[model samples]
Target chain A: MRVGLVGAGVMGRVHAAGWAAAGAELVAVFSRDEDRARELAGQYGARVVGSYADLLREVDVVDICVPTHLHHDMALEAFSQRRHVVCEKPIALTEAEGREMIAAAERAGVRFFVAMVLRFFPQYRLARELVAQGRIGQVGVIRLKRVSYTPNKPGDNWYLDHARSGGMIVDLMVHDFDFACWLAGDVTRVYARAAGDRYALATLRFANGAMALVEGGWANPPGVFRTAIDVAGTKGVIEWSSDATATIRTFLRQPEGAAGEVGLPLSPLAEDPYTTQIKHAYEAIRTGAEFAVTPEDALRALRVALAAKESARTGRSVTLQGG
Target chain B: MTLRIGIMSAAHVHADGYAELLKQIPDVDFIGFSDEDAQRGQAFAGAHGVRWFRRHEDLLAQQPHGVIVCSENRGHMELVQMAAAAGAHVLCEKPIEVSRERAEAMRDACAARGVKFMTAFPMRFDPSVREVCARVRAGELGQILAVNGINHSENPSGHRAWFADPHLAGGGAVMDHTVHLADLLRWFFQAEVETVYAEVGNPFAQGTLSVDTAGLIQVTLSNGVFASIDCSWSRPAGYPRWGHLQMEIIGERGTLVLDAFAQALTVYAKGGARWPEWVQWGSDPNRAMIEHFLHCIRTGEEPEVTWRDGFEAMRVALAAYESSDQGTVVRLSP
Candidate 1:
């Protein structure tokens, strides 16, 4: 598969590495800055395309790695050219844009995949599998936190702009929103509050009667990334944290006053999540296998994030339409 | 001169720790104790080689220089009133009286009698926390922008039954765990909390427990510093220790990370104990708090953790419960 990458930023560099490990032909690279594109292209021994139009025509797959607000336009353009598309989350800044992009992909008969990389993470995958197998029965409550340092750039940092990047909730926390939905199903209501641009907390009640408290923050020191999740079920509970030596832990509901959580070790995956996601997407495109996250799945995650932002803005609980 | 201090009740989980601190301090007399649960109180007093007063008032009537009120939540006010009436400086265990009115009354009674009223916010006395606060005050971290903290603990119901009873404890983890960090943050910013929003769950016991055992609380301070606290009793039984306090403070110039109980030696032995014990090697904050309480009384000075500080911290905690109950952000008055 020939892949042309867009927006040679941090994520662009990450995806370029992913594509190389995925064994895809990195046909070309495009960035608004010619120097960035040239740098990435040189590193990967790929050609640098001068324009988005030229990059679209150069490869079979278009990977959009630009700022979130540009996702709709780039994905739309990719679909218009009949190229298979992989867009990073959140699919777009608005639901309307998300719908239009999905519709465009459907009309063009091209595969549209969103890089919700959490689904590719080994621990999260195992957690979902365990829940599916009812290792922990009758899910009741979940708590997820993804905290990191603020992304500070010298100039024109799109992430600091809420309109462009949707701030922390849509940009950073959308991962947890997607993961929570995947674990507990569609959200029925959301109550949230934000502390400036850095911190946000949201409580989501799922249609299945499970509740999830999702917390995200961008106030820590630079390069500090911490993620933790706790899922409580009828028969037991499952927990995992990035800071722990153990990968995952589970506690069965024993008789009263018994020990909780038998620590379980995870078999480390060979490939990083980025590489795995990239490889999975490429394989799905070639073999017609199911992708880890569909455009609609990404859209549902976006809706929950938007609902959280709305709740934070209005100081009231926001109800969602069932997907 | 030795400052005589009496323990009011042995009901609080920290009662034994306080007694130990009193014993360790050379200048403090570890006087007798009293509790409504006479057998339990007598057992504790006997274990510590102190007299067991049949009536709680009898212990107060000893006219000790200071009294450590370690009764259950609802019993704090009466103990404080009795200790204050006996002209002893009162060192009340936190969430001061569980209600703002009761807490204020305790403070007023102490003030009218010219007695020092100290809230036992031992976290404020933690050496690591004190160092961080000192740096912040010195402008070493610049203007504090945000604070995040966690006070995680084992299910207190495993430690004491009263912890699961809302009537006796006022609230659950939100009440028991919130005040320590709340007091610390207030001290750090020298400001009151202006607004509070909280999310709580009973994930540990799946609501089979009477009170909530988990909480995530956000507070916006009058000093423009935003803070969040995870006051949860979700620690596992086999966890190394009962709990630890952790905080991350982000400032304009620098950031500070504080683990209040991080200086510990973990003992891991096969077939030795149910859990690997994390023996704390750090300075004992409880001892510092007791010494400070005695020093305030000896010098006729107000306590660093004054009754008003306790009231404000308790008010913020109570507001957190209300916010969780109402499912909205609650604003506090100045």
Candidate 2:
């Protein structure tokens, strides 16, 4: 598969590295930074395109790692060129924008995806596997939390400004919000609250009478970071982490007697989300297999994050706008 | 050798169950219970066929080797102080007290008096919940992704206004229902709550527990599993005295969902018009807890419920209240 990468940012470099290692053809890399773009492109054995339009000329997959504000317009251009678009987080700031991009991609008959990287995380993949196997009888509830130091670099970091980044709510939380809906069911209603525009809390009631709570923040003092999640059900509980140093644990309550612990640790892979996400994308492009993170899934997540922001601003719970 | 135990404060609802269980244990002596209210003292004593006294001091005068402080939440600190002063070991119920400061006092008093102090957290003894913890530690569930706990009951405030008042209950359903779930989650995963996001309501709390009938608790555990819970005392009555609890611990190889107390086979009388077993089907949770307490006391080992366990549970509950106050998430110090 020939890949053209846009936006010579950290994320773009990540994708370039992924394509190089996977034997996928990296046809070109595009950026406003001609020197940096060519330098990074050469590392992947690909040429640098001076303009975004030049890269779209012949690539099969044009990954858009540009700023959120630019996603809507750039994605349309790539879609019209008949190239699959892999956009970065926030997908476009709002579900409406995501829809526009999705509609364009559909009209062009090209695949589209939002990089919700958890779907590619090995521990998360294993969670879906356990659910598939009925290891925990019918998941009844899910609770997720993602926390890290609040970025002080307001203008440069991009996550500090609420307008540009949507703060933690959209940029950080949309990932899991989409995940909860993907696993549980359609989220019907949401009650949320925010503090200092940094930390956010939202409770979602799924159509299945199940509930999910999401806590997203970069407001804590500097540290490595902490991500924790738990799902409760009829049989037992499944708990896991994003940190590679930790292993997953299932608290099973059946099959012969009393409650007990079952340690399940996945084999560590050097290739994390960056490599795996693209692998899934290429896999999807070839076989039409789902990229794990679909446009609809990404849109649902964006809706949840946007709703939380709206709810926080209004001090009222918001309803999930169904598409 | 028989372990002579003194019962302090018969005001707590679960006190009678502990009295009955102690009598059944051949190794335990069913010593008299003390109640500030003599009516409660006699009622508890007569109902369980145990002895009683009007004052906790008089009860401690018996010089029993151990004491069970089953009193009002406010009285926990005082009763624990008395028991420790008398050089008697102590076992108290959840919350330890209404505040962390008071709970710490009780712990410090117990330690200074060189007495065994345990808080009765019976959910730890349930076979189903423990199984989940076992499998998690054994690495069968793989690297965890998330954890959740559900605890619901008829409102805690309706029956007792003190359960709703901040000075008495400390918080609403957030305090009443949170400890058990927090302790259970912490024990099962061996994780601490790092941050909390909560939405508290006062719906069913009518007279006592307040209108905050339901609450959603969002938290992150130290082990890096994002966790949350829907805890409340807002279920419809006649449905069941107890609501329910379910948990999902998501992992690498598989997920573990634990539905503790999912089923209870109730016997129906022929041509029954009402639940005839209201008299017969009393609480078994209390019985299970007391039995485990005796098991630990006799074996000189830690019971499933320890005082430190109660402290951590209280911390989680307090954090939830803090989250509730601001209507946002609050992170706890490591």
Candidate 3:
């Protein structure tokens, strides 16, 4: 399968390596910066497409890795060319734009997948499976933390702009928002607060009566990336943290038949999470199988994230119209 | 000169620990204790080998120089009034009163009687917190941008019944836990909270935990520094310790992160009962706080944590509850 990559930046490099691991051909590369496009294309031995439109016509699937604000237009154009599209989260800045892109993908009858990479990570996937299997029994509360250093790029970094990136809640915390929904079902309401552009905290109430607390920050010193998740249920609790010696720990209420405070072993999957996500997308498109992270799923996560930003701005809880 | 101190009530969870610390103060006499519950008072008094006064007035008859008011939330005002009327300085346990009005009245009554009134905010006495506050004030971190704090403890209802009563404790985690960090942040920023927005939940024990056991309070200070405090009672029964106090202060130039009780030895109990416990080996903040209280009384100077500080911090904490109730930001008088 041939693939075309857009935006030869950090995410683009990650997708390039993913495509290589997935055994797909990197047929073309496109970036506004000709030098960046040429550099990435030279490493992959692919053509450096002059424009987004040219890249669209060159490959069976187009991976959109551009800035957040450009995602809508690029995905729509990709669907117009009847090409399968893998767009990075979030799908778009606004729900309306995201809806339009989804409609376009449906009209073109082409596969559309959102790169919600957390779903591909072994820990998060295992967490979702545990919840589904009722291993913990009726999850009551979930706490997720994703904090890292603020991104400092030399040029105009669109991430720093609230208008383009939707601030930290949308840009940084959409991962947890998506994961929360995947684990706890639909979010009914969200109340959030932010400290400048550095940190954002939110509480999500699910339709199933479960609650989730999300803490995402960019205020920490550079090179610090910390992620932790704690889910407490009726009979047990599951916890994971990047800083811990154990990858995951589970505590059961009744320990007679259970190993209390059992630590889950690490995933033996040698490939990176990004590679897993790309490989799944390739398999889904080739065999006409459903993508693990659907476009509608991405749209729902975006809706919650946008609502969190609104709640932070107005200091009011935002209630979603529908689950 | 040696200072004499009496315990007004033995109902507070920290009362016994305070009494133990009081016994260790070399120049201070741990006079005696009184409680509304006679049996509880006698039990505590017997445990410490001090007299258990049947009435608060009888305890005051001893003419102690100061008293630690470790009563229930509503009980604080009456105890402070009695201690002040008896010509004794009062070191009141947190949340001076359920409401700001009562707290102010207590403050005024103490002032009218010429007695020192101190609120117990031991985090201020924690050496690590003190160092951070000192460095932040010295411009080591530049203009302060934001502050984040967490005061997490085991479900207090498991330990104390009054803590779960809204009337007796004001509120749950928001009331019982928010004050200490609020006092500390007010001290660090040297400002009062201008606006508060909060959310509270009882995810662990929805039908059982009577009041909110998990809460998040976000505030904007008069100094333009935004802060968030997580006053959650989410610690499990068999956790390492009761809880912890952690703060991260960010500034224009740099940042300072602090864990008040991080200096500890982790002990795994035999047979894995109370599997892991953090035995604190750090400098005792409670001792330092008691010492400061007595020092202020001896010098006839104001205490480090005053009644007004307690009143102001309570205002912020109460504002958090109001915000959570109304589902909107609650503004406070600057």
Candidate 3 stretches greater than 4 Å from native: A126-143, A154-156, A161-163, A191-196, A203-213, A230-269, A312-317, B271-273
TM-score of chain A of each: 0.92, 0.87, 0.92
Tell me the alpha-carbon RMSD of every candidate.
Answer: 7.6, 12.6, 6.9
What does DockQ give for each predicted structure?
A: 0.21, 0.05, 0.27
Candidate 2 C-alpha lDDT tens digits along A196-234 = 444566788676655677766654334325577666554
TM-score of model 2 (CA atoms): 0.57
lDDT, candidate 1, A1-323, per-residue tens: 89999988877888999999888999899998789899999999999988899998889999999889999999998899899999888899999999999999999999999999889888899899999998877676677878776776545788889889998899888999999999989998787767666677777877876767787877655545677887766555677877674455555555632321111112356777888889999999989898878988899999999999998888677878764
lDDT of 3 by residue, B1-334 (tens): 8888999888888888998988888998888888768778778878888778878999999999999999888889988988899999999999889987788889888989999999999988988988998999999878887776778677777877889888898888888889888898899878888888777766666777678877777788888787778787766677778877988787766457788888999898797646677888999998999999989988988888988898888998889888877867899986
Error of 1 at B25 (Å): 1.8
Across all models, the iRMS values in order are: 3.9, 11.0, 3.0
Tens-digit per-residue lDDT, A100-165, candidate 3: 998998999999999998888888888889988987777766778787767664476777887777
- All candidates in order of lDDT, best leading: 3, 1, 2
**Model 2 chain A worst lDDT run, 10 consecutive residues:** A257-266
In candidate 1, which residue pairs get closer than 3 Å at backbone N, Cα or C atoms, i.e. clash? Answer: none
Candidate 1: segments with Cα more than 4 A from true spot: A35-59, A80-82, A107-109, A123-157, A180-270, A307-323, B270-274
Task: Give me the runs in candidate 2 sitting further than 4 Å from their true place.
Answer: A150-155, A220-223, A242-267, A321-323, B1-31, B34-175, B179-334
lDDT tens digits, residue span B1-334, model 1: 8988899898888998988878788887777788878678768978787778878778877779889999889889988888888888899998897898899889889988888989899888888888888888999877777776778677777877898888999988889899888888899878888988877767666647878877778787888787778787766666778876988787665457788888988798787643578889998899988888888877887788888888998998899889878877899998
